[model samples]
Target: MESGDLLLYKRAMFRLAHISDVHLGPLPAVTYRELASKRVVGYVNWQRHRRHFLHDGVIDAIVGDLKGACPDHLAVTGDLVNLALDGEIELARQWLETLGDPRDVSVVPGNHDAYVPGAFDKICRAWGPWMAGDGQADPVGRYTFPYMRVRGRVALIGISTARATAPFMANGFFGNGQARRLAALLDDAAGKGLCRVVMIHHPPVKGAVAQHKRLVGIGRFQQVVARHGAELVLHGHSHLPSLYWIGTAQKPVPVVGVAAAGQGMGGRNPPAQYNLFGIEGEAGQWRVHLERFGLVGAAVLPARIAELELAPHSAQVSLSPH
Candidate 1:
């Protein structure tokens, strides 16, 4: 390897990167034909209204950052592709394969991943090889999306919040079913003194869910979190990074989202970004340093960094909350 490559590898050893909402491909290629609803019209309108791209800019930008960060493990909250198009899923895999070891990268599904019929099944079957590691055991073992990992000082509790609700809904769901098992999974993780990271596609509370009751069921979900007292909660689907103070919980566990990749291909900038988490300090005093990275150009550059402080109940908290 070149001297520069060796230096990069050396630097990458200390960070854990968080990037979500890549939306990897364009409308036609990224989506199987839209369901018979307003969503179809929305997609058509988006293409006409936004920037067009041959390769989704966000994916390239994220891959570029991955090479630079060389993280221990990359955690993606969800929405890897715009739609569940076979090509889109394939596109996501191709990008992941190119960016970093598919092994080092972990993912949760967002609403978009389940937009089409049977999208999750096919993507999981095709991509399962890269998602597993030695001694990895499924928590629910029921679905590909809801799983767990004991990464570093934090124990990651990933859950499936993706669901196909109705035409009017662009929001997310965790289903009452997963809610039943979430507490158990979290209890076990916390009992071991692991700093819990609850990953989901939908915000347990925030955004459109605030205005529309039918948008999603964030209340019940937060109930599970309150009971378990998760250290951190990483989320996407809003296309904007956010931090909401969970009032009932013990402390403010950060709920973060990343801008969608390939932003302007549709006039939407997606804020095109990602973040890094640096875990350090002693046992009772563990800390998280949230660092921000933005995509500068189409060539996969992530520059412009910032940091946030994480309390014990903190996860990968991003600076400059939108």
Candidate 2:
């Protein structure tokens, strides 16, 4: 059944907590061999700048506050580690444990998590359970990108745009391969009467980021959504609170970008904030109540943003598929 044909319940509700770009700090020591590739540039930048902005205490306070709210599920949009070092991945694993159990958390990788060639594979191995699909587990319990996990009436789809890039570039790509699979996945989930949420690290809209840090194949990603459609899109690469609309088969999908969860207040960078979304309403008329929580003084508290109605409006014009 197509999503348009499904009958959705009016009061069915789900609460989700979204935090991204943690960039978990104080990168571990790297050997000369590790810095041979792109690590050298990242290392230099971290030492000179990132170390101060991405604070451990800030993230701890933010997580502590999130736990107090206790949403139904947690979605981390990536950049958990700065360098993707062996130790960094392990450290992120321990941090994930602190956030929540694998069963309650869904994660997707970011450009920083796959900063080097072999680091992508390393992330898959270490963060497998967090990104696993809804299907039966493999004998080895391995994971693949664009994985889907169905939680109650919602289907959380995880897509990876995190691939190693040359120095000075913080870009991501959703190639034709992932695009095709994503379209099918969205359709399947929608047909099952699920509220589809696409989780990716990079924004799928053109000009969303600098040329060197943008999602390279955003056109392909947009095309897939235009054909299949989704209820909500959650991403984290820009490190700013943002809301954009993308054209889909039945409506304009709302793509939300969150600020870096661990960032401190002293710079041009946005302060640490996480998004809370209350999803409710029935088929064809879903509503997402959005609340942004940020660091103020020593406390992480609610910064009520806006409540959004996500379904396509009757008189709303369709967005171009650029």
Q: Specify the highest-TM-score model's number.
A: 2
Query: After superposition, which runs of candidate 2 have C-alpha atoms over 4 Å from their true positions?
Result: 1-12, 139-143, 248-250, 297-322
User: Global lDDT of each model?
Assistant: 0.63, 0.82
The whole-model C-alpha lDDT of candidate 2 against the native structure comes to 0.82
Clashing pairs in 1: 50-266, 50-267, 51-265, 51-266, 51-267, 58-261, 58-262
Q: How does candidate 1 fare on TM-score?
A: 0.79
**What's model 1's lDDT at 127?**
59
- Residue 50 displacement in candidate 2 (angstroms): 0.6
lDDT accuracy of residue 202 in candidate 2:
92
Compute the lDDT of residue 292 as modeled in candidate 1: 72
Worst 10 residues of 1 by lDDT: 206-215
Which residue segments of model 1 deviate by more than 4 Å?
1-14, 27-39, 50-55, 130-145, 208-215, 247-250, 265-270, 282-284, 296-300, 312-322
lDDT of 2 by residue, 1-322 (tens): 5564432322246889999999998888889998888899999999998998888988987888888877889999999999999999999999998877898999999999999988888888788878888773662122356888888888899999998899999989888778877988999998888889999999887777888889988888887888888888999999877778787545788888888998887756677888888888666677787677776554455344444444445223221111
| Collision pairs in model 2 | 8-283
